[model samples]
Target: MAPQIVGLAFGHFALRMNPILLLGALTGAQTVTAAMAAIQERSGSPVAVLGYTPAYPIANILLTTWGTIVVAVIAS
Candidate 1:
C-alpha cells in the first residue's frame, strides 16, 4: 500500500519525464517483476528495464543486510 502510494505519486510527477523509466524504477524498488513485465507490454518498450536494473540490486542488498541486522539484534 505504501509503496503503491509512492509509486502513484511518482507516476504523477514523472509525467514530464520518462514514465517508462520511472515505472521501471518503482517496480524495481519494490521487486515486482510482474509490474515490470506489464509496463513493458503496455509501453511496447524495454527502456524501463534500464531503471530497474540498478534499483533492484541495491534494494536487494540493502534490505537483506538490514533484515539480517534486525534479526541478529532481536535474537541476541
Candidate 2:
C-alpha cells in the first residue's frame, strides 16, 4: 500500500499520469513479494515480480550494508 501510493504520487508528478508507467512504478520486488506470499499464498504475477528484479539486489546490498554500519556504530 505504501509502495502503491508512492508509485502513484511519483507517476502523477513525473510520468505524466501514464497508466503503463504508473503500473511499472508499483513494482517493489522482494519486500512486496514476500508480503504478498504470506498474505495470499502467492508472490504476485511473474511479470510484476520480474519488473523489479533489477532493483532487488542493489537495494538488498545497500540496506544490508547500511544496517551493518548502524549496528557496528552502536556496538562500538
The per-model lDDT (C-alpha) reads 0.86, 0.54
TM-score of each: 0.79, 0.49
Most lDDT-accurate candidate: 1
Clashes in candidate 1: how many?
0
Model 2 per-residue lDDT tens digits across residues 36-72: 3333334334444344456556667877999999999
Which stretch of 10 consecutive residues in model 2 shows the poorest summed lDDT?
35-44
Residue-level lDDT for 58 in candidate 1: 92
RMSD of 2: 4.9
Give the best candidate by TM-score.
1
TM-score of model 2 (CA atoms): 0.49
Count of backbone collisions within predicted model 2: 0
